[model samples]
Target: MSSKGSHSGWTRRRLLGRSVLAGAAVAAPSIVKGAQPTFAQTLSISALGKAKIDWQQFKGEDITVAVIPAGYFNNLIDVAGAFEDLSGVKVRFEKIPPGQIRQKILLDLSSKTGTYATHAADPMYYPLYVTNKWVEPLDAYLNDPKISDPGWFDYDDILEGWRSACSIEGKPYGIPFDGEATVQVYRKDVYEKAGIKPAQTLEQFVANAAKVHDPANRLWGAALRGFRGAGQNMYIYPSIFRAFGGEWFDPNKKLVVTTEPAVKALEWYVNLLRNYAPPGVENWNWPDIADAFGQGTVAVYIDAHSSAGVINDPQKSKVIGKIGYARWPRGPAGKRVTSIWNWSFPVNAALSERKKKATWLFIQWA
Candidate 1:
């Protein structure tokens, strides 16, 4: 999408052009300075719904982007044209299904198929990416002096947990974008009507869920994701496990799937699903979660904060202004555990020197 008058709020320019690989930047001298871009010069980017992707100059060449359809990012139609305008490289973005995106990329990279020059995958996969050596290191680009707006990334604003996940052995593996943390989303009106404050601990959360749950009146206490797949296994399970004093791996990084915490967390989660959730929650994903919260069928939604935008949007939500946000409830461990969802862009390691240069340039400008 076209962005006018520069990005406001937080601008990151220092990270530009620091560690850029010489060959990657130097190989695309032609695309870099050869032809003047003939794309539309002016596009309205100030208004939320007014932005358009500039497709004039990007009629040819090969480029691809991977994206998931959720959060405010469902507006993927706006990114390509702008990239095409800035670089003559043709843009070919591949949007993947939310549940399948991570596994798809992992499989692609592990097999060395290298279909995309650049792809946007979640930061949660950083551990897998690093382990498999499927992603190219971004330090060169980050350290390059010619790149612009390195600080635009706002590394500090990212949650520390996510930061730790993206980094391995003190080296960063991905450029982070978008943040979704599990927070307590409740019905302010209902809470007031019941004269109950928002819940802040596992004990309090369960009690609150029971209080708000009135299934006979068609209102459930909570909306939980219990679908048995990556969504359930990864997204929904982590928080419960953590709250039950479970860590995915032992101190030595070995899997601890059969630990006491694991059993307790799963038991608690299953109980919530069996008692407090609405019908057919076993099939829910992002949309189902958003719909439940929006339709006011669930009084407390302990899901990602990304749904906040959708629930708060007037055009899409039926209970727009009534939903309120709060810190996640405390667990037995005396800590708040929130699941992390992140999307990030990565470059393919196997591209030709010429293509690599073009890809690096495109990523810098993007």
Candidate 2:
């Protein structure tokens, strides 16, 4: 609990900043050897034992990690047995749907139930956690020699934007486990067939989508999230908001959504979806968009770069080699802004000391 950091890496200025990984397909460390994700990429059971820390220090402890049943977290579940074998700690990862998990985690945190020792928390909630001191400042565990090896952990390998989002006032409340940035996804075959080039600006984007908007053939030009959840519509909106040079607040931190750029961006988005995208595009999320693209219905769309992973899976994708990616298009402001997203694990403050340490160990390892 005495954890604090004077290092500039942990600063309040970066709380919840969006980040895009530089040139890496995936942010998490992995050495995969096959098409499907497996434990082969995660840390080897013996490699973890060679670390200086005593992996078995908290043997016989039990900790539960609350997580969504997403690909990133499911990948962790596949390899969790390695940690359990090395440390003798029983880890129960409770996978819940996103909507229900939020309610569960909020209830657990607000009530101080300690039911979940850790969770893949929403970054936006870090400020509230820091304000209420509801989560452990992770600098203690990161710097503690007996518990972690900073060099081996390679915290620096993580993008600064992701690191910043998990920290408030230089105190890290969470450890980033997965991250992605918004990018333009399109079908190479569609573009080649239509002779449409990738859009460089917002106007060009619409034009390009229009050229490929073939409703008669059952192919739509583009898609964007219209669902109302925070991770749904709100998630995709920020990129367009930033691209139009619309900041969330002014100098006095006053909310400013009525500005010219903001309105223009909103109108542009509505028109794009209303005119060119497939039916019920208004209710789509990232998954729906990805699924549509993989099924060869959507000619182009903009979303998290990670969608490539799903669309490239030959097992389920119909456009494996036909898909393409590019940086998000610029808006009237001449700025290209990509939405940064991540999920991180934070230790619950309500847990007992032993359980907290056990949770930290799990965070470090898996």
Candidate 3:
């Protein structure tokens, strides 16, 4: 979509095309179609220009980025107008819900339909992408003089754990945007009134929840992600599973979901939410749980650290300063296995060679 962010013939891109830094400031970007802002006024054209590559080479191309609707991903969409102005590439953001995005991304890539040039990716999917050759090796783009300036991109600035986790043989298949771990968030005021401290162990965790569970007051004990998706409940469950001493695979490399530890962990987790959480929690996702906590209807929550943004925002949260944060509690095995994950953006191998250039530009700029 063409940005309505333009006035007369002036744009951040037009200014950039003439002088890298001069006349940098203009009107705040108008909201473009979807969530994109109007111009790349905040982007440093001078630094990118130093690479001596043609930023406008793909000026008329269009690419779509399939993103799970979240703050970090929204931050990228917010500035897409600037990218569109700068590259003359029309960018569309499909802000799919978290539950449905994984399936769509997988199908788009595996089917090689090129429906999306890039997508919000999960770090765990890199190995499969590499093995199946479904994604372009990003090192080629990162090192290409025609499309990249490694020094300008600051390749080493990113954490090795995150960067390497998205690479195969030093060739990155994805660009990691956000790294997060699960944390326990509860209402401190409610806990104080109930005469209980935050949980340090699974036993204490449930006990604390039970102690504060006051559904009669419209306050349930806890709200957790219960929606059915690998990236939904499955994303939050591994921490619980590891805490319960459950391993995903046996030493011989067979799947291990039926093990005693696995069953015990799943049963405990399911029962906890079903019994103590608000009604219909089986259909809830992270945002839903966060909303419950923000609206003062839930006393505690367990989900991604990023969800804390929603729970702490004064604009949307009533609990505000009333919330307390802590590490995930210990399980019966005495292990505190917090969930660790990252979201990445990868170029779809399905995209045409020429379209991949525009996709790389978007990823690098983002």
Candidate 4:
């Protein structure tokens, strides 16, 4: 395939990196520095898109980046050799766990250590990062013709929702590395045998789940994240809360989890797990749910779009062509809500100007 057609797959893989290592949430740092790269020929198109930018602009600079040890960073490491050769910039990566990356970045910034010139920023914790002014605003680097080639980078091509999610107060703190949303993936064969179409409303979703549930025959109605903790609950609850017209906080920012809508949302969520989910689902996270769906042990699974890629891979999935994808069903409020997750690369404000600029070059390259 041509580079343009294949680029989306690469970007999708990068987006899925953080969630790849399930149940391995420990804090340790591993560094990957690119060796001198050699290329066979001059390529016309960049790995990013159809447009070509002058990547050699920042020759002979060194940059250090801290990232969660997800698939995205692994892919980045694979390509770093080429970037080093093209730009003459030695790129070093510090791999940290997804759960501890934020704390590590904060400490490095506050201590003026500049240990990491750039770090990955998760949208969930971006508000706090912005509040503390820990990341450098990327507007200047993005707009500079010398730094970013609009024709090549095509910043506007990024989905508006994804772009906006990475921005705070209308200013972009970082460039979007990956974007994803919650989606429902189901077994087409199972639905066909049961004579039911994909659910279009919340009520139908629940009913269909119950209808196809056959635990006695080793089939499950649904596979969902049921693990307790902010990381696990955050994925499933936000969409339910939004679907039910429940807000996390009032206009004054007071707690509102006990509101009528909130209660209904939580009740529905818990009941779905209690009644339809497989045994021991209470401890299941994304990886567990993904394994169930891929193994064809579940009829329906709802989580990030990242899992769909794995489920559709013929070699990795038992139900390859039998999968169907759909949006979340509409709630009683007539709204079908879903939450977004994005990873962005933001330069550390604590870095020297030269280091920041060099780091920006690497960010643009990635």
TM-score of each: 0.77, 0.86, 0.85, 0.81
Clashing residue pairs in candidate 4 (N, C-alpha, C atoms within 3 angstroms): 17-70, 17-71
Question: What value does the lDDT take at residue 169 in candidate 3?
Answer: 85
Q: Name the candidate that leads on TM-score.
A: 2
Instruction: Report every candidate's CA lDDT.
Output: 0.63, 0.77, 0.77, 0.74
* Decoy 1 TM-score against native: 0.77
**What is the Cα-based lDDT of residue 23 in candidate 4?**
18
Model 3 bad stretches (over 4 Å): 1-43, 47-52, 168-171
Q: Which candidate, 1 or 3, would have the higher TM-score against the true structure?
A: 3
Per-residue lDDT of candidate 3, residues 96-178 (tens digit): 77777788888988899999898888776788888999999887887789998654565565668878878888888998777
lDDT of 1: 0.63
Clashing pairs in 2: 10-170, 16-165
- Model 4 weakest lDDT span, ten residues long: 36-45
Residue 111 displacement in candidate 4 (angstroms): 4.3
Off by over 4 Å in 2: 1-43
Report the lDDT tens digits of candidate 1 across residue range 208-313: 8898899898899887776766655468678878888987788899988888878888888888877888988887876687877888788987888777766765
Q: What are the clash counts of all predictions, listed in order?
A: 24, 2, 3, 2
For model 3, the local distance difference test gives 0.77
